[model samples]
Target chain A: MSHASGPPPEDRIREDHRRAVEGAPDGGRDTTPAVGRRGGPALWRRAVEGSPVALARQAFKDARWSYLYKDDTSYRVRNGADANERIQAAARRMRGSTEIPEGVDANGPFINAPVWTWEVPAYFFLGGVATGSSFVALAADLAGDERSAAIARKVTIAAIGPGAPLLVLDLGRPARFLNMMRIFKPRSAMNAGAWCLMAFSTAGGAAVAADVLGRRRVAKVLGAQTALLGTYLGSYTGVLLASTAVPIWARSRLFLPPIFVCTAVATGAATNRLVLAATGMPSGHPTRDALGTIETVAMGAELALSSFNEKRLGQLADVLEHGRAGRLFEFARWAVRAGLMLRFTRGRFAWEHHVASGLYLAGGLAFRFAWIEAGKASAGDDEAVARMARGKATVKDRLRDGRTTARVRTSARHPGRDARAARVYADAVRRLSLAIEGVLRRG
Target chain B: MTEIAIDRPESRRMGFFTDTTVCIGCKACEVACKQWNDLPADGAVFRKTSSYDHTGSLSASTWRHVRFVEQTEPVPLPDLPAYGGGNGGHGEVDLVAAAEAHGVPQMDRWLFMSDVCKHCTNAGCLDACPTGALIRTEFETVIVQPDVCNGCGYCVPSCPFGVINRDPYDGRAAKCTLCYDRLEDGLEPACAKSCPTDSILFGPYDELVETAKGRVLALHERGVTDAYLYGAGDEPGEQLAGELGAFFLLTAPPERFGLPAQAESPAQENGPVATAAGLAAAALGLAAAVGAFARAHRR
Candidate 1:
């Protein structure tokens, strides 16, 4: 009713701002004594009011004052009202303007959150590379690329140097590392990871021993076994993480194994490139080019799969995309891109190969390190965990009519059906995730 | 892995159903747990800050902890008119008159809940333990074989609840054994035995669950709408740590009592790991085949 002949919306906003500024000195000051500030207008005006706009801005900063203003102004703005009253009236027009009460995370919820440190991620990274190196060695040996095979074998065996100590170091005692294989239970991923690492290391060690002893048949046989164990070693760590209740790790359960395996191959091939390049394997050689191409594809797949999982994770993506872990994840992406560019450049410098492989290795390590840290961040946040838990629907369910229950409990009585449902639940989630990712990419 | 930690057919399952509503917050259970377990006093560092909490959390030393959470709201309990029984005429009359004159405003409510090890059904720490240091007892409770533990700290992160901690002096993972020694002798845990108000009740698992359900129903009838059982079926507790040996009757959100509202047990929680492994293998195989094809084409 008051705005019957007022200016346009934009101009009205401007006029309101001007009026607010003009009324600030006296109108805001005069109302202050009623609110209980000492020595009233003089002190408060000196501290708060240069203009009504300044006072309003200060009030916005103060949650309590904003609440009072919002509470007072929310209905009708009087055209000739006092500036403070007009400001309140203007604020009343805004939607969802609720006061934020003062509170605390009194329980120190995030403290003692995640105990995983350098040793665990380092073990995962080195062990994965070793596993992939063994696979590369096996592939080379089968392809009759003896020169590539021999170097691959040496790299595979040698990669265990840091890997062995890392596992032992995390265990805190050498005997404890041995004690991990007290009994093998296929159901437990940690147990399986432990035993897989042990066996792979043992076979890798034996193959290296045979190389020195000139036992050709023995070395080949053991190398094949190690490569087989490498399959589990390279990817089981992801399964191990997925098997845990950790929010970040568990949410990415479907994609983690594939991502880890891809990373393992990329890192392993990068290490192989460094070894071959250092040993004077010329650029554009068939074996070298093949390994580099394979590494590139694997890494690209890893990035795609990681993005897919992150998309499905919804709000939980903050941990992997926001904090210190987020920075490391960002660094890995750049490193991957830079490394890929260097690998393709025709006239790349001899040192360019070294630098590229170095970046690839750094990227691999960063992925593992950031993943562990992100798991910590994910666990600390209550909201993210809840959101992820709520995302029980797989991509299939999202698209289809028969949506699986929010949580599917498997009964022991119907093992076969329950197992099938569990498998379907998992597959539906991953397939749907990939589908959603495809849509997002196209969109 | 063993389904429920306390489902052993040979021995009856035992647990504690702590009713936080009636907890006195005296820290007696904390003292009793340490005393009976022969634990060292690490909570004595009187940090003058923080809430009125000394034994802030359950740790290797403090097996039980009473958390005092002070909330600034009008007190839940109404002002009583019968205090001092109106015995002293001048003082009592003056106090009553003063009470009528000034209304109680912003009365602080301290939510005191004693916490102990949850002894989760699908124990992540036990599943994650590589050295077999952690084991599910025949009594359906989980315990750490301290002699066998090599302090790998694997169990530390595995636990959804921050219950287990390493003894800094001994360098081994230690936590509430549910008084395994006493349980074997048919005795309740010291914390339950010592609770003055019977807030901490120990008995057969099923019976304790029934008692908790009844108490929650009673509280609801009495208009305590927020009162719900933690670790009770149909709650988020059942979703993760189903039928927890040590559960609670909380008057507010689990977070208010420093508890995770939705606890997840890794073993019970399944995802697409197996399918992902298969996909990974298939992708690698395809990549390898493409690499071979490219080499042959170049030839």
Candidate 2:
């Protein structure tokens, strides 16, 4: 609207100077336009103004000034408007426009969230159970419980049935599943896990076959070999998860494998115990007592290791405490607790042992799902990923920042007890994060 | 005697040295990379918060990404005068007058960086790929062999820089190859060739490192004291197995650009983790078996 008329003010001013330099009789004053540099005649000269159209326009614009400019935050432009002021106003608007909200990662969601779905966790559960069953079969044979050993061997084969297929089904290209066996890269946990799974399945299957054929010596030899590979099969998934950049899984490296192995044994023993009970094995049977003891110890260890790892994860543990994963973890904890309680206070009923076994199996499966889901959540957490990548520096920086903020808030609230209160608060924080402190100091 | 055969000289290790100080944020490198690689479009979703960086981060389809970080905090521009227009109205932006009136409007700096794969010497993806799909080229650039990749998705999580990704449509992992095909034909990478500011310099690894060091020194001489080389490091954690094939000269902290401060191959931690896992499994598995059998004997 300002540029809706003739030549710009600068051009007009230059033209006026050119005319004055030509030695015109009346200089450039008479030829000057009524609409000048400021865009209108002075208010005092309004009555003598030559252009009535320009004067009328000015009066109308002034009358509607408040209405037009009321909502505009840059209303100070009414005093003076220039390119610099306009640019500054734009910069101001841009600055206020879309600030990355507090706690939102400015640079990233970081690593690609794990692409695994239900199939992977399901496979983990089945694989763990199979490995655990193999161990049970070997142990039972050594204990001279041939009946229970045969049942354990059958269980191992049963679990391995769907485990291999579930793992293949989770691949992006399922048809290319055989590619995993094309290389023997022990450096890769996944490759090592694949080989272990194959070895365990082959040996376990042969053992089950031999047992059915009444070849006890051949079955025992194969069962021992299967159990040897089962150690990796049950625990290498932990290594697989830990060897990645996912914060929670990688941070819980030392605990995840042991936790996984414990769950495998617990679930395996539970399955074998339930089968034996269903076959009318008496409650006083030595095999039943052994299975019960093994299951109980394994469950206890799983719970203890999980708690320790969760404490070490710090704020990264939030993924395991909120959302779907959190609910699954909660259920798993309760299921294990219920199973342990039933084991401790079992009645004469065989159904009580069956129920306890069922709880342990369900709990182990739920634990696998919870860990997988927690890993996905942890991978998507930009702060946790950044903390992992930045390593101990970010942890220390955040801890220091947290302490300062706490001190400031406390000082503002209680000036007299600032030092003492701050010290107490800092000490509590230090204790809470002490699990990671050793690693940080070592690094 | 058998006829003596002529031998070819050993291939020189090549790399990219990205000097982000002079980058103009033109995004020519992004276009050139996609155009040359024949990669698919990364969908059309206008990201309102990520500034002009619409092609977000480096992914399977988009190999080179120009990161735009709009730092709006008020920073001191020491070289420029706060007040302006004293001498014949030449000064356009009267920052002092504007600041005095508007209480210092936030317009500090607009940092632009062209990010690509770090192509680490000890790449986590290469180490973790179970299918033997990811391999290091003669130029020392890590590339995923698309034909061989089974899309097991192991490499996706193993990359510490988050540069490699499994394409949802293709169902295979993909990332920058450092223009291996172009290198074979004695041509520079498309991204480096198309860079308007010569920000992305492609050359022999040793020569590029020297050039990068010289540029960093020049920047420091010109008062850009904060300028430092990332990935071209002597420190252990700063480099992944000695150095990255594609390193950067950055003014801001590495995290500000989504690069890790302590860059390392996640696979490097495999030894201790595997050892502990194996020990734990052995101890727990053996103990449970032994305890179960011993208890049966006692009974």
Candidate 3:
């Protein structure tokens, strides 16, 4: 019926006119001809109106819209429920394939997980052991007490056993840990440290072993030698972190090493006190009191140094303020406070003081853990790295601009445009090439 | 034996002018140092993914470190590409265009600076060290004595720039000696010698200062208003005021390059606080111990 006699030409024209006007730009001219000129609405249809590609493209667009807006997935399975529920679920499903969950092996490959060097923790442990042993020795020497010396020897031996293992374990190849002693390279702190530990450990172990074997006279002689070597062993851990190129570590070098030394002493004192208490040694013993005093001093120094360094680091202070480092620092602070409280109240609360000493020991270990963690945190972040890169680029850009300006200034004095231009261009090209090459190579 | 005058100021002081402006972040200085010193390649294997720096921070093996920094700016110039392309690459020529085309609000810029031991005038590391491990050489450069270091690592935190580090393997503090061996032979440091752009300039302390001043003036004249010399003036202390052994002509704030703008002495900062705390703790402990002894005697 429509083919023979559709609506009146005027009626069809009005309907078509409304559709065209709806699609036109509000402020633009209407360029479509009257529907009457084409005879009817059917006359306005194009030859490619039913093209499959066009329909597919529209279908793709609809599917993309659903996929982007809705989280519906393509996979479907029976839920042992109603069919109506299934249909509803299917309707909700987005047209595109679902993204595989992360960590699912069947999904796809992912970036290799990052493995941080364990050397940081090893450094922390060794430094702690060495410093702690030194404090014991220092207290013993100051008090003219032989028992303290005995305790110091014991602490030093313990330090060597655990500290040495940690240091070796930190090596990429544990077997190669011994290779550090192959040569005496002065430029390498680790090489120097390996030798120091070897000598100190050997001497300390001899003193400790002799004492254990009931050779009091020999032990005394060996103890003195151990003390001499132990001081160096304890102190060097501080310098080890300082000698590096990491800005955060290097900038805080002066304080970091000292802090480590002080921390070690505190840890050693706490450990000895805990041992004395567990062994039922008399409370308020002069040696125990002296050890506590040494621990208190060392803890104070370590806390103060860490706090000062963090404050001075400014934006970089995030390493100590947040994440795992922040947690470590928090625990360390708690331990230090508990230790100080116990030491202060030692006369009033003897058993409580021992408990506090235990806390102090925990705190010291935590401090080392936190310090190492923070240092690693500092190295892992992108903000610091990006900041450093930008600083270098700024300097480089200025230098390049300066050189170019200098060349232009020099070339301006020349008479010939060709020669001056050639010189300037060549110089610019050379400089640019070098700059680019440098960036690429660095990357 | 003839004795040197203690009060008379030393005339010849060696120094380093790490231009930072021209540093390519190659870390050649670090590698060259280990090679020249015959140091072990310990931390070299730890490739840091956060930045181009793989060795993380300075350690026993790495004496000279080149730090890489990235910064962002609001204005985008079409001429500068994010990653610098090669000499003949189209990216090189169209860097400016690409930057402009992106029309992004923030654009990143890179910085590279090779850092080394400051070898300061006061040398806090030397002052704080108990074993006399850290010492000022005849060349006026601070060096850690490996034999004497005792692994105390006091010098590590004593340094304001954190340049000194102790080796984990040997337990000794180590750092750049300004290639003291090379200096002894009247040769420049391996870093300065190998630097293609002369970014790591090695010279007499006074001459470098003067040259740095002249360069700063030249930069200002060329409209590089941000250029300034750090650790060159006498603001922080009289000792550091005259010149820095390892100074820098920085384009931005020194902190951007991880160098504090004002010199911070770690020993000075912590000294009084630590001392006060130590004294207080000692007094409290002694008082408690004495009271405990008296009570025990009474019992």
Candidate 4:
């Protein structure tokens, strides 16, 4: 064998023959010996001999083959079948029922897990805050509240400082993030959002710089421009999510954007309220009260809209009420509730207002995290995806009055065992809404 | 059986017509695809639950995957030893023979489907791509330019079928190109060529659809009434935006093969609705802010 320690006797003899040929007068012309001098067979002959078919043929020729191992597996041999006879038999058996086979898990085949992690939600939160702050700045400037406007402009700049970096960090190729600007695609929400973010950041920076430089006219114009772009920035993250095949996000198409915007406005106003209060703004100052009122309304709307959409999501809504997303959402709900409570019960103490603002901001940020986490979970849910594909998950389906399709049959492998949990969930939402109503009435 | 001719002046829209019924759970196509594409193996994962499907689903490295859905009824544990004794040396129960001999009910079955990228008419990944990395070839198949993809991962969630994915090693999104290189040389895709039963057919798009329809009809005539074409039609105002370049003739529902029956490109409907809603909310917030500030100023 070629794998042996030394050349075989035949190769050794051929080498001696080649040396003899070289020593002889006419042997130099004889190339045959030179061809045989190699340790193994010729390349072509070796290739042919080494081929699997050749080896198998040789094996069969040597009487090594039997019915037990006649190029078929032991399973096939035992079944006494040939050419997919077993599979054909199975296929024939399956024709009796349309129901999917028991214990056959379909979820294993779906690979639509969300790639976006914490950085994406973090970026979304930051962008929303920046946009919100910019809007506040614009509103304050327009209302002739220069001091509030100045503070909001500073907040806008600070909030947007890490927006692009965080977004780039989230990319699979961080260095290639600039490629996002290579094309102008308005149809793609991510593309539009990227451009809006860049533009908003630029306008915000310029507005802040102009304000510092005493360029009042330039600052106002730029502030207005910043706010305009901020509007897109505040809600485009939701659009980005909605424009994906992720079931929960796509189904909440009409609501996600508005919900995001409400949070942005709430968080922005909350930040302003906290900043003003921290600067020793007297209790019930006109600007502080306005900011608080704006924060309260926006936070309230965000809570209501999210609850409505969560209900609309049907069975798919389990993503939001369970898992990591569920925990985060639970925290956000309490934070918003506490914030609203504090806002309603305004005391003489400035710390009370600061706590309320802090709670609103925390709630808004947590909502973003919860939504993103839920989206990740939603993408992996095969039944939810199937439901989405069947036009049963979206409001568009209801508008078309789609035929009431049967719910996906649950199995031991799949998730859908939450009837009692769902009841508790509904009760909680009902009680929460009632509490919100009572708070509003008392206020 | 349309022969793939080598000498053609121009490329016609060609695609795969995967008939799942005739598939025999053999993973020859998957092997051929991996060998031809020089794709990295998804390192040893012994999946005890998913019968013979260790690779799981189609992903960046795995362009073609054979999905094994075992529908066989649970055989009694006591019958197992008896079948082994009857079968002699190998000591394995002959499940098919047992079912055929009425030892087990004939309702037991196994379904095999080889899944690949759908290559939708209005591909969500292509539309949602911000870098213009994804493009439609002359054959009407969507391809991602590796050099252009910045790995923004927008296309990852954009795919309705979850075929495209970013490679963990490089972070660049990768998927089946329908063997673009092979097609350019007038060769059939590796997966189609390797399919032993002609389960994965390759030909002109229109011809393939007709052939698939005929195959379904033929199956129906053969008493396989469940056989139907998925991603074959352009239903007006339906969720499926348009026809799939690579479609399937399935015996079970699309979801059984991890395919969405009524997938839509989010760009067409969802994108617009979201943007409109966002704009409206922004306007509302802006107005609210202005009004609130005005009231504060008066105070």
Best by lDDT: 4
For candidate 2, write residues A311-348 as lDDT tens digits: 77778899999999999999999999998888778556
The CAPRI quality class of candidate 2 comes to: incorrect
- As a TM-score, model 2 comes out at 0.75
Of 2 and 3, the candidate ranking higher by TM-score: 2
Q: Write the per-residue lDDT of candidate 1 for residues A1-443, one digit (tens) a residue.
A: 01114333324444555667675765432211123211111112344543343223221121122111132421112223243232222222211012111242324342234555588888888876787778777767666666676677788777866876776665533344444555555556777777777788889888878877888778778888888888788887787777665667766666788888888888888788778878988777777776776677777777788888888766667888888899999999889888878867853477776677788889999999989889888777755443333333234222112112233232212113434564455445434433543465478
Q: Please identify model 4 stretches exceeding 4 Å from their true place.
A: A1-108, A394-443, B1-9, B74-107, B237-239
Model 3 regions lying over 4 Å from their true place: A1-443, B1-11, B22-59, B70-109, B168-171, B236-243, B296-299
The CAPRI quality class of candidate 4 comes to: acceptable
Clashing residue pairs for model 1 = A73-A88, A74-A92, A395-A432, B6-B140
Candidate 1 lDDT by residue in tens digits, B269-293: 5323443564467456534834563
Worst 10 residues of 1 chain A by lDDT: A92-101
DockQ of 1: 0.07
Model 2 misplaced regions, further than 4 Å: A1-106, A393-443, B1-9, B48-50, B78-106
Error of 3 at A176 (Å): 21
**Residue range B110-179, candidate 3, lDDT tens digits:** 7677777777664546545544345566557777655344444445545555566555444456777888
Residue-level lDDT tens digits of model 2 in B1-299: 00001122355667888878768899999989877776655555678775767877888778899988778667644222222213114556655565657755455677799999888876778778887667666566778766456677888888878888876655678899898766655667889878876778877787667666655554444455566777773443224434788988787666567766554556655535544665567566766776777677675
Per-residue CA lDDT of model 3 for A1-443, tens digit only, reads 00113453334555666777775768334434333222111123546754343223321131122121122321112223343332222212211012211221110000011122454455566555554664455445445556656776787787676767666554322333333443343333445666777787788788888878988768777766665555556555555544432334534544666676667667767777777666666876777666666667778777787887777666766777799879988988988887777767635767777777678777877776776667556645534423322222122221112222211000001123445564455345434533543465478
* lDDT (C-alpha, whole model) for all candidates: 0.63, 0.70, 0.54, 0.72
Stretches of candidate 1 off by over 4 Å are: A1-112, A172-175, A210-218, A321-323, A386-443, B3-10, B45-50, B75-106, B233-238, B271-298
For candidate 4, the lDDT comes to 0.72
